[model samples]
Target: MTPQYMNISYHDLLKATSGFSSENVIGTGGFGVVYKGIMAVEGIITSVAIKVLNLEQRGASRSFLSECETLRSVRHRNLIKVLSCCSSIDHRGNDFKAVVFEYMPNGSLEEWLHPKESMNSQPFESLSIMQRLNIAIDVAAALGYLHEHGPVPVVHCDLKPSNILLDNEMIAHVGDFGLARFLIRQANISSPSMTSASGIKGSIGYIPPEYGFGSQASTEGDIYSYGILLLETFTGVSPTDERFTDVSSLHSHVKMAFPSRVLDVVDSKMFLERQCPGTKTVCAPKSAHDCLVSVLQCGIQCSKESPRERGTMKQVVRELDSARMLLLR
Candidate 1:
């Protein structure tokens, strides 16, 4: 059943976002522009993020319906909260469509992963190992919910750091359903990477091998993307990083140096040394690299060339749980 979305006046959204001014802009993508807005809700003022469709965009219409369709059925704590959507004409009589979501205060995971250097910054900090571990698990849990617990299986065709949002508490929320696909023909919509002749099946580097060969979007495809996301999280390198060449990829780069030289590729921001809390003294309870190696291996396995060979999301959840256990121990 499609959840009834709130119908907001275009004028209200316009006023809330200050006419969607450049200053209120938060994020921009192929489908449309998102703006931070303040609105009255049930007699109280509420903060919201409004995603306005860029009708001029090629697939913006399809993307809008796809997002609305997918989000209506899926609900998870780690998934972004959807408040409502707007489908109407603006005061000027131009067609307008938008989706409203709960405001995320901390911005995106991309910002946290790769913060830009600033003149006033005292020092640069990277996500701690514990923090990354938690995020990894958070993503896995969200995937698990979508795949197994949802009314129908949903595949997050595009899974990348930027699509993951963080709240004030630093909890992860998986957003961006513009390219979502429901398995077994629940809905028919193509992902951003889908093309008649292999433009790209997903994001540039995260596309699964099978998707490039004209395969339909499947849970396995999502697993492949997840694997790449896991690798990127640890290495702090985008799958499309300049260092990667046609002959080598983020997967191969990690595989070749894993275990033997894991630290070489790990982001320096992520503190590798396992130390006792509240003290500067080294108190390594165990070899931190051992757990890291396990993570890398799981990532490699999930990104297998053959979809049949890839680990299921269930296995991913289990393995990540174990990895988190190791980190804690």
Candidate 2:
């Protein structure tokens, strides 16, 4: 059956989201708060992430509408799916708006990577090298789809690990389109006014140098952010660390460390028991050293300071695919 497009009413959304109860709330950000919700139609249950706007806040309505417009028009497997939206006055007679998205049970990549809170007795296992490579490929594919397959090129202004969610199947989904922008014909333009208190457009560590130079947000900026994410995934360290503060950028830090055979910076959890004898916690594959080398090399390429020097998402995806195939063999 074809899925009919219908705007969800505000009342229906409230019931689906349990009246936006705090217990159901899963996450919150500058744009809005996200709540876990269940919807049943024809006796079929479906889980969703409901993003409810903070109407009392300034500029919240515009951001909500902007995200709605972007997600409603774009579609991709790696991108979060927006099922519907609700925009109406609530019982308090205040404006209410929300977006319903496919729920990601596993939560954001940041939780897995940094984990602010301890995962006591959670049977937490570090992701294998192969798993990391697969996630990078999935994210690249999603970005590629947005830049090439969509009706208009979309720039995900904020591409940090926190915004990348992993589903139950470990499939990566790019979420938080609140800061996304459409890239029409490429031309120089002034930076968009910053919305947050930081006075910075993108996340601090991931913001592209080009953006500082007054270049408008472009696909290249997204590429730069992707590179930072890749580096963060490989190395358990945050991009802006006291050690790396001396270095001009994350790219340079990684590049200098690469020549020293210091992939040891990679997450200790990722290698664990797999680490080679007489070495640090970093692991070396039994027979796929070449594959590991390739993946690391791709990371280096992506982290290049010059956007023109970095490989496209298509190329990144292909490289990861090749590495994954080698690891499987």
lDDT on C-alpha atoms for all candidate structures: 0.80, 0.76
**Worst ten in a row by lDDT for model 2:** 191-200
Q: How much does candidate 2 score in TM-score? A: 0.86
Error of 1 at 202 (Å): 2.2
TM-score for every candidate vs. truth? 0.88, 0.86
Off by over 4 Å in 2: 1-6, 41-43, 56-58, 117-124, 186-200, 246-249, 276-279, 286-288
At residue 55, candidate 2 shows an lDDT of 76
The residue-by-residue lDDT of candidate 2 on 216-268, one tens digit each, is 67777788888888878877677776676654666676676674464555666
* TM-score of predicted structure 1: 0.88
Residue-level lDDT for 223 in candidate 1: 91
RMSD of 1: 4.8
lDDT of 1 by residue, 1-329 (tens): 56666668889899999988988787877889889899976567988889999999888888899888888899899999888888999988999999999888877767777666222122335787778878888898999898778997888888988888878777889998988877653335432222222222467888998887778777788899999999988888888878889899999999898777776677755664644477544333354566787788889898878988887888998998888788777
Alpha carbon RMSD to native, model 2: 4.1
Clashes per candidate (backbone, < 3 Å): 0, 0
